[model samples]
Target: MFAARRFSLYERAFGPVVTPITSIRGLLQDFTTTAAYDAAQRSRSNDDYFATIHHISNIVRRDIYMERTLNKMCISKIVNSELVYRVLRSCSRSGIESFRFFNWARTHHPHYDPTTLEFEELLKTLARTGHWETMWKVAHQMKVQNLPISSSIVSFIIEHYGKKDLVDQAVELFNRLKSFNCPQTTEVYNSLLFALCEVKNFQGAYALIRRMLRKGAVPDKKTYSILVNGWCSAGKMREAQEFLEEMSRKGFNPPVRGRDLLIDGLLNAGYLESAKGLVRKMTKEGFVPDVSTFNSLAEAICKSGEIDFCIDLFRDVCKLGLCPDVDTYKIIITAASKVGRIDDAFQILHRSIEEGLRPFPSLYAPILKALCRKGMFDDAFSFFSDMKLKGHPPNRPAYTMLIRMCTRGGRFVEAANYLVEMTELNLLPLSRNFDLVCDGLKNCGKHDLAKRIEQLEISLRGD
Candidate 1:
């Protein structure tokens, strides 16, 4: 009977059961994937496009041997330039996988070459990930194909090199742009100037500016703005102000971003009086600085022990009919909380909500945390409940804070309930919270409850 059974199994191995279960599973997956492919092709939503690209790239990265199969299954029929561009954009986080897919598409497929924007995205991915060897290979591919190297690409390369303090490398790239057939435009000049200033090479940047002038490249407002920003960030307020004045005299207004950078720099350098004066000047000159700029000044004032002045300034700005953004409210709320004026914080919260501003979780966290630390559990829980009622529930940090507070106060049951809620919400409580809860429960002689909670925590973690 055993011999007859072995012979039957051997015959089946050469028949319908020849293919393994794994192979069958793969076939089923391929069938499902075809449906996904059809859906992806018909998708018009940006989120769907990104998710599709991410999904395809993930498959390619899953197994070295599966890339060809995945490409044949999904990417082979893709001929849309817009779709390809979106795929390249989605590859920003996975440089190697992106490079592999790009190479496979370009070499094996032969129907799709990298577009200019695709190449740009690839270079950006390469730059962000420090994949210099592959970057060089991609650049060589561009060169071989006689692709027109863009000035923006040149600037991108130079800016990245400058960030790494590789000034010589950036300079070499600038000098070699002619070899790449990229024209040295005024924008390119400004980019190089910005790179020099980024490395604090003001002397080198000034020389480059002179060279640009000699080359008949007129410096634009961006050029002066970069210089002003560089100097301001370096704490050379005098130089920054001089450049700002120079820009104005040359019939160029420093952009709002530049103005904000200058304000932040001044406030950070303890030049509060100077920063306030600049804001006043800006308002007088018909340049109403944004709320964020004003927030920076207010925060600096609060940090300098002038919380009252900061609050007054916030109110005065609102009276000017300029809507205070979430950032502005956060700054004032934080300042009030720091001064133990929880009532003031809540008052501002109500006023902001009454003014039709949506309160995000970020706006609630600091207030909840501050109240919890002050032993004002009633007020903290009140705000937490209000957050949920307003359809903006407290997130991980808020819950963690409450859990820790409860456990420390020997409220083990409350802490465990919060922990359970965190697990249900898929928010992992901090390790310290677990420790505190376990120890608090044991100290209360709830040994069985403690054990059960420990097992629940383990199960939640899939251990």
Candidate 2:
């Protein structure tokens, strides 16, 4: 009894009991001839058969008697067969976590199978989903069990985890790959560098770039663009510019659009002179300035109250045989008007029209307002009439400006007539315009006319 119990304990602790070959053959023949086994074999391919066998092994392993019997049978039949490797690969892809069993089988029973492709696919899938810990376990299994893992596979894992911001895991895997004598490729360095830069870890990014250079991995234009953008974003315009210069010296042209972005960053940070200088340098480099670049420069100048400089820049653009678009004219007009240069503002309007540029209402509205504000009502009215005759009728805002100017200049009859015209044009008179008309009539001592204006305002409000 004592010997039997000891044997049972050994079997339970280790594996299943090995039946004799005669008994195993009998069992195999019995199952093979059975309708159930025939149907299963006919319906499932060899891949699915192995999958089913592994699943059954798992289930039997949970039972003490069945586990001992199955383990003994597997050992007897040679655990690390080609069929077993396919089964293991399938389990790994299916997330069965039975790879450890395959590791044990391969360790204790030597066998080789050329299924590295499937294993690599599994590793890539796992890595893509940020399963780094599983990836580490699989890598260790592959190394210890003598399974093949390629450099491309290792690099793929590293790149994937790097993109996920799992830098420690990526580095750990990278070190393991180095132990495998895999050289760091340019793709690997680029992935890590970009990842570091994405997190704004410029120190890490810079170090990685230097390390890659030491590894004889030449930095490309993309690498420089990333660093330059990072520096510019961090308000290190000097550093960004220096890097750009370095890139140029190295026979690389960093993207011209990057210069525009750098200029915008500088301008937004109140480094107007640096922004302007950078734009000038970019222009001198024969990089054509995009509309947005010009707009940013113009806006920065206007914000700094450098209206004269903005006008000069627009003039310079014109002198370059580049006809200023309506938007350009609008910017110039706004900048001039903001500085009380009404004459210059109108000069831009006339020039735009003469250049065959269609005048948009937005362009004319502000100019008319500037004229009215400067007490140039006759000039404003004349421009409005000219615009109307030219088939670009004054809009609501323009008519509002005219009505306001008329009332403010004590022209009550003109104000009233303009109000009627605005209504005819379906442009509702604002409350301020009504107030203006009332005040104009009262100021002229026309009390009855003032009352009439107030009554009309009430009627309009009711409608």
Candidate 3:
């Protein structure tokens, strides 16, 4: 009797178990057909999600009674928090409309509760549209909800105000942070400092830094960089140096070395010689500069038409225990290629690989370009093939570049082959490239090949 009762209970809970498909064909179809159906369903669901948002945006934009119309459509039942946020983003430029949609979601949608994501997104949207009064109202609402605004938002607003030359407003915002229940952090201070620097209010900017220290908020790398950069931009290197020294005396070394900060400042200020001299002194004394700091200097020097000098500097820094990054190799390789030093470019490329860096098109394309420039077509082809063989295949831009180089050299057959190969790899060959190859082939009396190229374009485009 207990066994019968147990079986009855199981049947009530799970119902009778459907018999599993026993045939091989049925089992295969269960996996293969069901999986494909599921994938298709997901694709359709994604399409519907975007379509729904677009439809809502259109209504919000055109209909005066958009909220009522959405309600009558039973949007409250279907709408979710994520859907509401997406719709807000879609109509973001329409600040009033975006706010209405957000408000509608909160009040009307059955289960749609606004989160911090929606709140911050609305704040940012309102701020972007210069809806200052409305933005404050939203902030007040956030405080009511116990959600204090983020420091990032403060920084963005300050930067915006600085861009519009509203320095006073930026300051007002900084001073008003306490009322918003936001703590005055380094980022908040940096924004104000940046605003001061924008207006060349160096005196005020410097004072702000001292104020930061007094408030027990330590200035970070960005703080030092900003002040130093501002001073450097104004050609007041002496004052910048004095400020650094004074800060050092106060037991506040920057997160990065002060010297690196100075170099970066000098570089931004267009005082390349001062930066170069400072770097030389550091490296000469066996002090390794930050790779990024050195890279900035190296990049700047290369642009000044002294790539060879930059290369020497790269080697000197490497010897002093400074490992180079991908960007470092990219800079030297590009410079070498531009000056027709293919051999040196090749050596740099290999060196970067040996240092455990993968090759990118920008890194190797220059060498191919240099080879092509010097009529070393075979070498360029060999290099490209070798790259593919070693698992670092060129991307679309690189393929387009190679095809263009081939066409330029009257190698239409090779160009046509590459065009096919690119398509085989699922890269869309531009229609213009197809026309160029077809025309070239026709002009060379290779009509058969030209027809094939034309047919391939038509097929790929599904026209």
Candidate 4:
């Protein structure tokens, strides 16, 4: 009997394995006879659950037949918590009739926590992948189905749609939460405030802030900062100042960065004296001007051609132990040159170099251009040569200026020599430079030299 049993087992093992189709049919037959199956079929009034079951069965692999069988029956009979969650996940994955599915899940599973790990993960995935419209639909469905929407879910929608500038949808969602008597938090207001500020919709932001305040939702430091900075950026410094005063009255000092922004806005809008007064007041109130603040003040002073005041401010900045950056020198040099004080510019340059401040090409470029424009070609060329010796070679603009200077001075040979030097440095002479040299030679009664230069140009072009 043992030998016969062994032979039978071996025969079955080596026989052709039954196909999945055959196994599925047998399982379906068994399911049809089970109590759960009978109850599910009897309870199927609408085709929604049945349709979802059919969709899921058709798509899922045959390997997990039992789980699918359970899922189908679960959807049809009782929309319990676990079963509803499965439907929600299935809806999320299938990307069809998600609203319907989510509504059904929420209505029947009202007691289920919306902040469950599973739901949060799914909502975040939908949000991050830019499925905001779908997420909006899902949130709406949840509300209609009388399920408690999670704050996290609302935050996700707010962040996503807000970033995309879907202001209407974001506001709708926010109102929905408010209608539900959900407590407003700083984070929620911040999200909406940021959305408004990002699009520069100050009116909307101001309205939103007031509304939140009326609802007993106090704005935090960050909230106040956003409004102050936003107003300043929109060139409404008076409004920003008003808000700052209000903040102070409310025992809240504005952030350093926000104050800096306010000061800059005031200065840019031609309120220099007001800005200086504010700086003094802020300093008295223990708000020292940072490097950026001093920098902006210096820039405004220079721009207004108040060089003497700017020089004094520069001294104060140095006294504050803040190392002068390249911009500091630029502002001083630019102002000096603008006011026809080339001597002052040269002195600043010398002092900057002596103080171990390496001159950037940008700094020298503008100064050189200014010098050349003032008919100070000798000084310009000297500066250029010094730059080269200091391992900071003059750029194409400097070389072009030199070419123009030599040609204008009726020194064609000097221009030609400079052109050769430029070529040896692998820099191409501009066509204007060539034209200028030709014109200079011809005007000096050196037509032969002009012709030779033109021939050189032609050869260079061909090569």
Candidate 5:
């Protein structure tokens, strides 16, 4: 009778000796797959994915009673490695967050071993986000595992360090090529050199180039150009020019723009004649300056209060069969306006039109403002009238300057007229500008003009 009662109690408590293990496994699989898919779909942005992961992690921690035992939590027993990888990929855009999640995966889900590809993906995310220290740790872990690191991965790390101005770290990484078992390539040397040059470490950079040559890596145009640019930036114009000549001797054509950069450096250092001589020499050497480079020189010259020199430069450039671009025309006209040479500015406008170049609104605005500042209202208005005749009415900036100048000069009636023109052109002045004109009119004892300006402003708002 005792045995019978024991059997009956066993039946009541355990039901059967066989457990539904397959069913439980299936449920866990479904839960993980559904959770991953739902989380990925819900993540519209990096921040969104981060929040989703945070929420899911909280639930897992609470459900697992992981408060005091997080490091020992067996999340993989419920979630699976496939689901973890998918989650990692989905949150890839948020590199830092992805890294945190990766750590959580490794610590909380000890059974879920990451594959080589998984580690690579994480490394990529870290590299892109400039997480170098973590990247190094991950790389070291891979190294400990005897996994092969790719050339592209090394290049990326070098380039990342270079761009961040971490010259020493970049150099250190490059030097570890043999340890990483990655062969050196010209591309890798270029990246290392670029980083060194970016920080103005020309001596160290040249040393690296020598090492590269010893390693059978040929220096390319980019390598030389970077060195030239570095010297120019460091105010070593003579050294930069010497490197350019050396680059040419090596049969790698140095970019014409490098000469332009040197010219700018010379001009800025107050070597006016030297700058001009460089420009002429570059052209004489068959290194023709492009339109953009020519404009840069002209603008720099104008800013240096050498407007006459700029005009002469413009004439010289025209003689070379290189027509002036819109920027070139703009600078010349601006220089002309700066010295109260309104007629010369007008002549440039006419020349640009004859050459079929349509000046931008920006080009016209400054000239108009300069004219108004010099009390040349008639000339400014005449220029505006000519622009209208050519189907290019004055834009908002031009109108604003004209109205502000007229009001400040105590011409309230003229300000009101300008406001009316703006309304007719469907251009509304800012409320502050309107207020300026209104206050000026009222102060000048023109109550009727001020009221009209207020009505015009109200109409602009469709009130």
Candidate 6:
């Protein structure tokens, strides 16, 4: 988020409000703002400031009775919201300790006062550790301080409660949002639905959706996805379709089709077989699954070691107007390489590039591994060089893999050349790498190259 800046009197004036940046007044204000920004950046980088937060966190983490210890330290200045938030996050796992530290920061630390950010973070930390009572206490404090608990925070809390299976508490929070002056927006409703679905309370989730409809709040895509996912997880696909049809009948059409929602949900709930069956059926009908859902299905199927079936699905879907994304290519390429299908992997890589996607090291590293596995050293080296010169330069892991393979293949001179190449790229080969190349060179009777590798390590280490 952009930080808030202090407005100057001249800049705040009505005359300059309409003035362009070319004006003298505007230029002066810009310089002043820039200088303040620089000073703020320097303050943020100060080690002492961070060390202070760390020190306070250590004390808070040890015991919940932080006020007395923090008081004795006699902190000389007021802490801002960000500092307070950082310390609270540091003590987040210990809910009681975080609350105690927060109380001290707001009430005893000089002229400090907690803002919405500090209050929200404290509540989130408390919720994270299942401190239900203390979380409400903080919410009440926020309300009493005339701070409205934003709907976004309410949604987060509800989502956390759902993950913990505390559906009742989640419902309670949603019901009491009016007390906190937070409206029951779509976000809050969706969060409650998620919590209900987490507990397999789809009936309750459906009721909540009804309430949202009654309140005239439009159901967004996430709302539809959540309910559909719940039904699919419960093995109630028939009910899921009926629900979508009902929504459509009510003139509440989801942004996507019902088929995509069901397929994605099946994939998420670990029903790979069911998802695959639906995908095959859909493609058979010339109906395209959503690209995101297709990519997810492909990734999941590839992991099951049925790469051929997944590749067939990829082709079938693409023919049916499903455009594969980069993730789709990555999954296919990786699985192809894993199965020693280097030619297939190369074909997928080229297709990704033909689709105008930038080729990256990850997209080709597996091919290098496959080549090395097959002892095709020349092919691996050529591909690595092409990737560096024509595509994105290979990253450290790629270089390391190539180096290790070279040593094992008795290509000591080539390995030494790569060690030098790494230095040119400002990528440090690992200590183990230097040992591998040097040992291989010594055994192969290339002492001059071995000495060069050793010197390279020494120069880089500045020893």
Report the poorest 10 consecutive residues by lDDT, candidate 1. Answer: 9-18
TM-score for each predicted model, relative to the true structure: 0.62, 0.50, 0.82, 0.50, 0.62, 0.87
Error of 4 at 258 (Å): 5.6
- Give lDDT tens digits, candidate 5, residues 28-117: 687687777677666656666456456555534344443334345444554455555666666555566666666777776667777777
- 1-463, model 2: which lDDT tens digit per residue? 4223323432332233233555557767788767969776777776666665676456433434443454555553444455555544445443324444444454555554435654565577567656667766777666776776776777677666667777776666665656765677766676666566656788887778768767787766556656766676677877777666765676556445557657766765577898777756755665545666678788779988889988877776565554566667888888898788888888888898898887877788777777777777667767777787888866788778778777767667657766766755678889999888888778889787577656656645653
Error of 2 at 204 (Å): 4.7
| Model 3 pairs in collision | none
Evaluate all candidate structures by whole-model CA lDDT and list the values in order: 0.74, 0.67, 0.84, 0.66, 0.71, 0.83
Clashing pairs in 5: none
lDDT of 6 by residue, 1-463 (tens): 1011211211232222222324556556765877778876788778778899899889999955567788888674637788888898888898888887787776666577778988998988998898989998998888789987888889999999999998988898888887777899999999999999999998899999999999999999999999988888889889999999999999999988889898988887889999999988888888998888888888888888799888777777878887888888888888899889899899989989999998888888989988998999878877887777885898899899988988888877777777777776789999999999899989988787677667667656755
Clashing pairs in 2: 15-68, 16-68, 16-69, 17-68
Q: 154-212, model 1: which lDDT tens digit per residue?
A: 88877877787778878988999888999888888888887898889988887886687
Top candidate when judged by lDDT against the true structure:
3
By lDDT, the candidates rank as: 3, 6, 1, 5, 2, 4
Between prediction 3 and prediction 5, the one with superior TM-score is 3
How would you encode candidate 3's per-residue C-alpha lDDT over 1-463 as one tens digit per residue?
Answer: 4223323432332333223333445656765777778887899999987997899989887789988888877666568868878877877788888888878877875577688888888887887777778888888898899987889988878877776678999999999988887788999999889889988999999889988999999899999999999999999988989999999998998888889988999999999999999989998999978989988998999999988888888888888999989888989899989989888899889999998899988899999988888888878888988898988988888888888888888878777877877876889988889988899889899897788777667656756
lDDT of 3 at 221: 91
lDDT of 2 at 400: 82
CA RMSD for every model? 13.9, 28.1, 13.3, 24.9, 21.7, 13.0
Q: Once superposed on the true structure, which residue ranges of model 6 sit more than 4 Å away at CA?
A: 1-45, 63-75
Which digits, one per residue and each the tens of the lDDT, describe model 4 over residues 1-463?
4223323432332245445566667877888767968777678844665676556534432323434344454544455545445544654543333334444445555565443443544565466556766665555545575666567566666767777877777778677776644555777787778668767888898789768767777677668766766676677778887767765776555556557767766765567887777776765565556676777887887776678777765655565565676777888777776667777777778778889888776666667767767777667766877888998776667678778866766657657656656655768888889899888878888787677666656544643
| Model 3 lDDT at residue 208 | 91
Best by TM-score: 6
